[model samples]
Structure formats: structure tokens, C-alpha cells
Target: MALLVAGAFFMEILDATIITPAIPLIATSLGVEPVDVNVAITAYLVTVAVLIPATGWMTDRFGIRPVFIAAIAVFTLASLGCAFSVSLPMLVAMRILQGIGGAMMVPVGRLAVLRYSDKADRVRAIALLTWPALAAPVIAPALGGAIATVGSWRWIFLVNIPIGVVGFLLALKLIRGGPASAARPLDWRGMLALGGGIAAALIALESVRVTGTNWWQVATGTAVAVVLLVLAVVHLLRTPHPLITLSVLRFRSLRITVTAGSLYRMVITAVPFLLPLQFQLVFGWTPLRAGLMVAALFVGNLTIKPATTPLMRRFGIKRVLLVNGVLSVLWFALLAVLHPGLPIWLIAVILYVSGALRSIGFTAYNTLAFADVVGDDLTHGNTLNASVQELASGVGIAVAALLISQLTPLVGGGPGAAYSATFLVLAALLAVTLIETLRLPRNAGAEVSGTRIRRRDR
Candidate 1:
């Protein structure tokens, strides 16, 4: 089941970002400015962010089997719609439709894994689910770039057809679940408020760029988003049955994941998105070459997985996170120094290290999120975490795009200096998470990691 959900996750993330390296080609195909096609990307992201809040309710009202399978079908069909799109509006519409399916697949699928997996093996289960999140974004660019460079961007969507078909068939045989015995009534007010806030927030972030940004639009969206989000938080706390139970956030470990862990996620997620574009645009590399270079992340992510469990068991989660956090800051600083003249192997080495640290951080944070939550709180925790993760991913991409655009001019060198400055800024932001991490007790997540705290530590 973890593998199944992981596969679905890969498909969802791949579809969402497959256009990243091909953005220029897509703009040309649609007969529009390259910047205009950002909407197609943001549309899908905002739709997914908006719809994610309701999936927990959906999985409970309908069986997981039904909801998961339906999502796969919808996602697959929408991919076809995206392929056949003749205009920007048509592509954005199809991507939005695809987002609806994505909004359902990940949260529902992850919820199933959480419910079924034994507590003793939660680390293992989370490990399985984490790979797609780490690998797909890194790999999608290479795959998309290859397709676009060799042929047309349309083939990117077409590729998902077979994967979706196989996944749908296997899900029927492997998945088993029914609606919860006591399903709570849908909280329409909470749902609308939360969903609206997320959409507005993404819109506000999406509105920012280096050139020709509508300041009025950004301010209006920001103000409306702040109002809606506050209302959403208030209503969720007061409602008898909120769309998502905010109370689950009371757990300290869980709170850290949604807060500091999300910041970590947002910063790391932007690296893969920014690197390829920087290589192609600034370094004058072909899309295929740039993407292949970024694929080094794949090697690093997987190669380090076997060692992660041992590292956690030996040093403990808190210790591992602190060390990794320090190294990540250093890693981001190193990334800022890249130039076209650098050796290819050296660049790959830096990316590989980035991937390894990312894998470790994800495992530690994901496992920590569930370590202290028991029984009933688990479901809501999973739902809330999933929602936040999706929002962070969307915002990360939007912010990275904006930063690259805005910082280039302000930094006063070129695209190269802009990317350099962005990495340094990201490094500074990650350093802040180290402060939050410092506040965690030494033995944090010791249960999941199976690390024994020493008497001296106590």
C-alpha cells in the first residue's frame, strides 16, 4: 500500500512540475509570453491547495478505495485534457481539473498508509512515502526537458496514461477500506474559509515577479488572504466539526513539522526548481543538459536512504537534525558559488549532497510529526500535515520564481548573481529553523528512531 501510494504521489508531483523545464516551449506552443504560462503552473498548484482541505472529509465519507481510485481516474483523464489543450485557457482549465484529482490522491492515499501501518513500523512507512516527494521534483525536470527538447511537450502528459492505468488496476486488488463508522458532518464553513484562504495566498504569491507585477493586485490578494485565513482559523477552532481539526496542532512535535519543518521543506523544494532554470538561462546550457545535471539529486536521495535509519538510531533525531541543519546551511552557501566555469563533477557533487540532506531532514520531520500523536489524533494530524505540505510546495515554487525575477535586478549583476543571492537568503532562512530545532529536547522522536537516550542526557 505504501508503494502504491508512493507511485500515485510520483505521478501527481510529476504532472504538477513536468512543465517546469519546458515552460518556454509551452509558451511558444500556446503563442504567448513565457511569463504568461506561469498561470498554468500556478493554477494547478492553487487548485490543489484549495481542494486539499476537503480530502480528509472525503476519505471518511467515502471509502478510501473509492476515493483513491476515483482520484487516479480523474487525474489520468485530466492529463489527456492537458495534452489536447489548444490554448492557454484550455491548458489552465485542464490543469485545474487535474489538481482536483491530485488534491484527493495524496492526502487520501497517505491517510490510508497511516491508518494501516503499525506504529512500530511507522518510520518505514513514512520512508516509503517520502521518496516520491523527494525524487519526482528532481527527476521531473530531466524527463520533461528530454521530451520537450527531443519532441513536443505534449508527450509529458501522455506518458502518465500507462502509469495511471497500471496503478488503478493494482489499487483495486490491493486497497481495502470502507467509510468510517461515524462519519462527521461536512464543515462547509470551515472548508470554504480554509480553501479560500489557501487559494488567495497562492494567488498573492503568484502575482509577484521581477517585472510588470501589479502592486495593487498583490496587496489586495494579500489583505484578502490574511482576512480569510484568520476567519478560517477561528471557525475551525469553534466549529463542532471543522473541515480539518486544528486542535491536532497542539502536539509539539507535530507543530514543529507544520511550522519549522514546513520552512525547511519550502526552502529545499525551491532548489530543484531554481537550479535547472539557472543552468539553462544563465549558464547557457541546453535544457536536457541542465536537467540531467539536476538528476544527480536522484542518485543522492536513494543512495543515502539505507544509511539514514542507522544514523537516526545512533545519533537520535534531534542530534541528526541539528547536524543536518548546520550542514544544509553550509550546503546552500556552497550552491551559491556555482558558475559556468565550474567542473561538472563538482556541481553534481553539490546537488548530490543537497539531495542526501533533504532525504534525512524529510525522514526526521515526517517521523517526528507522528511520534507523539496516538490513535484518533493521527488522522487529523495526517490531514493537516498533508494540507500544509501541499501549500508549502506550491508557495515554494511561486516564491522561487518571484525571487529569481525580483532579486536579479536588485542584486545588480545578472541572473547568476540573482541565483547566488537567492541561495544565500535561503541559507539564512534555514538557519532560523536551527533555532526552533534547538528548542526540541534531545530525545525527541526517540520512540520512532529507537534511539536510547543516555542517563547523562536526562
Candidate 2:
């Protein structure tokens, strides 16, 4: 069951990143600017951000098995739609559908695993579940580049068909239907407000890059987003049952975790997106070589996973988070100093270390966030965390794109300037996590094993 959940997660994460290396090819085939084609990427991310808040309500109304199966089916079919898309708009639409499926697949699948897994094994269950998410980015670029170079870019999406089919079957066989809980009325009003707010904000962010910084269109989008967000906040405050329970924020550990997690993902997620472009466009490496270079990140992430549990047990979550958070920022900052004459192998080595440290830092922060929550709140907390993760990833990419676009002119409009400035900005963004992480109580994970034991008793 853990393997199935992880497999589903891996499939989603792999698809999320695999398209990046092929972005240039996709742009060329569709006769669009490379930056313009970012819409396809942003569209999927935005859709996930907007739809994620609805996952808990969906599971409650439909039951986990049905929802999980539907999500996989939708994602599988959407991949086919993406592969066959003939126009940029069409591709964007399909990706949006893909995001809808992905948004549901992860949270609901994890929910199933949590509900079914013995309480004593919850920590290990979560650690195991995260493996695919950790591994997906590692493999995505290399696999994407390999597929794009030797075959058509369409193969990336087509490749999911078989995996999705196997996942669907495994899910059906291994996943059992639990006793159906009473369905609650869907929060239509809250959903509209939250979804609208996220959609408007994302559109505004994307508009900044799409219409350029000075365009009135960007201002209009920003205004609309602000209005929608204000209304969403008001709606949530007044609603009896909000789409996202406002009370989750009241938990101190959870609050700190959410803030730290958002900032952490914001800084780290940008690396894979930025590095591949840098290696290929700035360093003049082939897509395959760039992909291989990016693979160093995965290697680093994998290498560090073995030590994560022991590190948390030894130094404690807060200390480990604070130290690693600062180190990860430093690692990203180092990229800004890389010169054209630097050795490629050295660059890979630096990236590998960054990836390892980042994985360790994020894993610690994520696990600690839920260290204090119990029972039903655990499910709510996990769902909220997942939504925030998606939101952060979307914001991270949009911000990176905007920064790169702004820096392009200042850096002399070449790949070198674009990547250097982007890396500097990413490093700074990551540094902000140090502040959030400091808010964690000194003994935040003090009862770590107790929390595991408690989950088992439930």
C-alpha cells in the first residue's frame, strides 16, 4: 500500500518535472517563445493550487477509493490529451486537467495510506511515501532529455500511460474500501472564493511575465487578484465550515511548519527549473548533458535520505532545520559565483551537495510540522500542508520566471546573466526560511516517537 501511494506520487512528480527539459522543443514545435510556453507549465501549477483545497471535501463526499481511482484515471487520460495537443492553448488546457487529477491523486492517496497504515509505523510510512516525491525530480530531467533527444517530446506524456495503468490496477487490488462516513454538504461558496482567489493571484503573477512588467494588463490582473483574495479571506472568516479550516493555523508547530515549508519549497523547487536551462542555454551543453548534470540533484537527495531519521533523532528537528536551511541558502548563493571557465564536473558536485542538503532540510521540516497534530486533525493538517506545497511551487516558478525576465536586460540579455541573477534571487528567497524555521519550539519534535505511538493507538 505504501508502495502504491509512493508510485502514484512518483508518477505525478515525474510528469511535473519531465516537461521542463522539453520546454524548448515544445516551444519550437508550437512556434512560441520559450518564455511564452511557460504558460503550459504555469497553467498546470495554477490549476493544482486552486483545486487542492477541495481534495479533503472530495474524499469526504466520494470516499477515498473512488476519488483516488477517478483521479488516476483523469490524470492518465489527460496525459494522452497533452501528447496529442496541437496548439499551445490546447496543451495548456490539457495540463490544467492534468493538474486537477494530480492535485487529487497525492492528497487522497496519502490519506488512504495514513488511514490504513498501523499507527506505530506512521513515521516510517510517511518517510517511505516521500521517496517517490524525492526520486521523481531526480529522474525527470534525465528521463525528459533522453526521451526528447532520441524520440519525440510526445513520448514524455505517452510514457505515463503504462505506469498509470499499472498504478490503477495496483490501487484497485491493494486498496480496500473503508466504512463510508456520512457525507457533508459541499462548501460551494467557500470553494468559489478560495479557488477564485488562487486562480486570480496566479494569473496576476503569470501576467507579470506574460505582459511584461510595465503592462496595464498586469496591473488589472493584480487588482483583480487582490479583490478576490480579500473577498476569500472575508468569506472564510464568516463561513461556518471553511474549505480550509482556519483553526489549523492555531497549532504553533503546524503554523511554523507551514511557513517554513512554503519558503523552503519556494527556494528549492526553482533549482531544477533553473539549472537545466542554465546548463543548456548558458553553458552550451546538450540537453542530454544538462539532464545528466541535473541528475546530480537526485543523487544528492537520495544520499541524504538515509541520514534524515538519525539526524532528527540526534540533533532534533529545529536545530537540524535551522542549520540545513542556512547551508542550503549558501549552496544556492554559490551558484551565482560560477564563471564560464569553471569545470562542469565541479558544478555538478556543488549541485549534488545542494540537492542532498535540501532534501534533508525539507524532510525534517515536513515531518516536524505534523509532530504535534493528532487524529482527524492529522488528516486536515496533511491536506493543508499539501495545498501549501503546491501553492509554494507555483509561486516559486512564477517568481523565478519574473526575476529571470527582469534580470535579462540588466545582465546584458544573455543566458549567463539570466541564470546568475536568478540563482542569486533563489538563494535570497531560501534564506528567508531561516527566519520561519527559528519559530519552531526548541523541543518541537521531542515526542516524535510518542506521536508515532499515538497514531498507532488511534
Candidate 3:
């Protein structure tokens, strides 16, 4: 069961990261600029961001098995469509559909695992499930680059088809059907407002990059996004059974967890996106070389996985997070000092170390975030965290790209200057997370049940 669930998790996350290296190839094939090709990536991420909030409701409305199967089908078919897309716009549209499929895959699959798993096994299950999410980005760029170098960029999308097909079949056969939850009224209004707000905000951010931050356009988009967001908040406050269930916010530990989780993910998000670009644009490395270099992140993540649980037990969450967060920030800052003259192997080693530290830091954050939630709130808290996680990732990448785009010209497009400036900025942003980490209670880690959930918990 864990294997199936983890497979699904890996597929979703792998698709998200794999497309990064393919962007340049995609651009050339479609007769579009590389930056313009990023629209496909952004479209998929934004679609996931917009749709993820609704997954819990969908799972409740439809049985988990059916929903998971349908999600896989959609994602698989969309991957086929993406491979066959003849133009950039067509590919972007296909990616949005793919996003819709992926949006439900992780949370719904996770909910299934959590629903069935015993309390004692829940944390371990979650930790195991998170490996693919951690590992995907590590291997994605290298894999994507290799595929693109050997075949067409279309192979990246095509690769998902076989995996998705297997997943769908396995899900149908192995996933159990259960008595459905009583249907609660869907929060249609709340969904509209929340979805609209998030979509608007993401579009606004993307627009700032595409439209050069023209005051009028930026101001108008920002205003629209703010108004939509405000409306969502107001709706959440007034609605009976809001989309996200605001009552989840009442858990102090959960509150801190979600807040810190968002900030932490935001910082982690900047690394993969910026590092590859830094290697290619700054150090004049080929896409494949840059991707191979970036694979150090996965190495670190993999190496640390065996130790994450034990380390959390030893140092505790607060101390672990505080020390690790500071170290992670320093890792980001170190990139600012990297130059073309530096040995590539040395840089890879540094990144490898950073990746290990980052993996430990991230695992700690995720485990601690849900440590305090119990019973019904646990489900809602998990849903809310999933939504925020995706949102933070999208926003983080957008923000980093926008900043780097602006800084590049100012740095005279010299070797490593733009990359240095961007890394410095990211380091500064990460430094703020140290303050957030301190907000966790000293004994918070000790309070966690540290139990793994089994199939019956739901």
C-alpha cells in the first residue's frame, strides 16, 4: 500500500520537476523564447495551486479509490496530449489539464493512506511518502536533460504515460472501496473565491515577469488579486463549512506548523529553480551538465532520509530546525560567492552538503507541522497544509525568477553575477525563516505521537 501511494506521489512530483530541463528544448522546438516556454511550467503549477484546495471535498464526494484512479487517467491522458502538442499554447493548455490530474493525485492518495493507516504508523507513512517528493527534484533535471539530449523533449511527457498506466491499473486492483462519508454540501462560493484569488495572484506574479512590471499593469493585477483574496477571506469567515474549515486554525501547534511550513517550503522552492539557471546562464554549463550538478540535491535528500527520524528524536524539532535553518541560509549565501573559475566538482560537493541539510530541515518541518493535530482536525489540517505547500512552491519560484530576471541586466549579464545576486536575495529571504522556526515551542517535538498511520485510521 505504501509502495502504491509512494509511487503516485513520485509521479506527481517527478512531473513537476522534470520539465525544468526540457524548457530550453521545448522553446526551440516550438519556435518560442525560452522564457516564454516557462509558461507551460507556470501553467501547470498554477493549475495545481488553484485546484488542490478542492481535493478533500472531491475525495469526500467520490470514494478515494475512484478519485485516485480518475486522477491518474486524466494525468496520463494529458501527458499523451502534451507529447503531441503542436504549438506552445497547445502544450500549455495540455499542461493545465495535466495539472488538474496531478492536483488530486497526491492529496487524495495521501488521504487514502492516512484514512487506513494506524496512528502509530502515520508519521512513518508520511515520512516514507515524502521520499518521492524529495527525490523527484533531485533526479528530475538530470533525467529530463538526458531524455532531451537523447530524444525529443516530448519524451519527458511520454515517459509519464507508462508510469501512469501502471499506477491506474494497480490502483483499480489494489485500492479498497469503503463506505462513503455522508455528503456535506460543497462550498461552491468559497471554492470560487479561493480559486479565483489564487489564480489571480499567480497570474499577477507571472504577469510582472512577462510584462516588465509596468506600473499600470502591475498595479491593476495586484489590486484585482488583493480584492479577490480579501473576498475569499471574508467568505471563509462567514460561510458555514468553509472550503478549508477555519476551525483547523484553532490548534496552536497546527497554526505554527502551517505558518512555518509555508515559509520553509518557500525557501526550499528557490533552490532548484535558481540553481539550474545559475549553472546554465552563469557558469555556461549545458542543460545536461547543469542538471547532473543539480542532482546533488537528491543525493543529500537520500543520504539524510535514514537519519531524519532518529535525528528529530535526538535533537528535537525546535533545536533541529533552528540550527538547520541557519545552516540552510548559509548554504544559500554560499552560492553568492561561487564563480565561473571555481571547480565544478567542488560546487557539486557544496550543493550535496546543502541538499543533505535541506532534507533534514524539510523533514523536520513537515513532521512537526502535524505533530499536534488530532481527530477530525487532522484531516482538515493536512488538506490546508497541502494547499499552502503547493501555493508557496509556486509563489517562491515565480518570485525568484522575477528577481533574477530583473537583476540579470543590472549585473551586466556577466558570469555568475546575476546568479550571485539572486542567491544572496534568496539567502536573505531564508534568514527570515529562522525567526519563524523559533516560534515553535521548545517541547513541540516531544509531544508528537511519532506514530505511523495504517489503512484503518481514516
> Which ranges of candidate 3 are over 4 A from the true structure?
113-131, 178-181, 209-214, 413-415, 449-458
Candidate 1 clash total? 0
Question: Per-model C-alpha lDDT, please?
Answer: 0.85, 0.80, 0.79
**How many backbone clashes does every candidate have?**
0, 2, 17
**Candidate 3 or 2, higher lDDT:** 2
The candidate 1 region of ten consecutive residues with least summed lDDT is 33-42
Candidate numbers sorted by lDDT from highest down: 1, 2, 3
Can you list the residue pairs that collide in candidate 2? 119-455, 119-456
TM-score of each: 0.89, 0.90, 0.89
Candidate 3, residues 1-458, lDDT tens digits: the string is 66888998888888888887777778788997555565677678878876887776787787788888899999999999999999998998999999999888877888788888899999998888978876787789899878877898899999988898899889988776453568677788888888777777766666665334666766677788799889888888888887886678787767766777677777687687777666766677777887898898778878888888887777677778888888888888887888779887889888898888888877887787677678987777877877777778877777777776677678874736877888888878888877767776566756562433334532
Model 1 lDDT per residue over 1-458, tens place: 99999999999988877787777778789997555566777778767866776876787889899999999999999999999999998998999999999999988898789888899988999999988967786688789889988988899899989999999999998877899887778889877887788778767777776678888999999899899999999999998887777899889999999999999988887787788677877888877787788888766877888899889999998999999999999999999999999999999999999989998998889888988999999878887887777677767777777777778789898779999999998899889999889999999988889898898876
Tell me the RMSD of model 1 versus the true structure. 3.1
Question: In model 2, what is the error at residue 325, expressed in angstroms?
Answer: 2.5
Q: Report the lDDT of model 1 for residue 99.
A: 93
At residue 316, candidate 3 shows an lDDT of 75
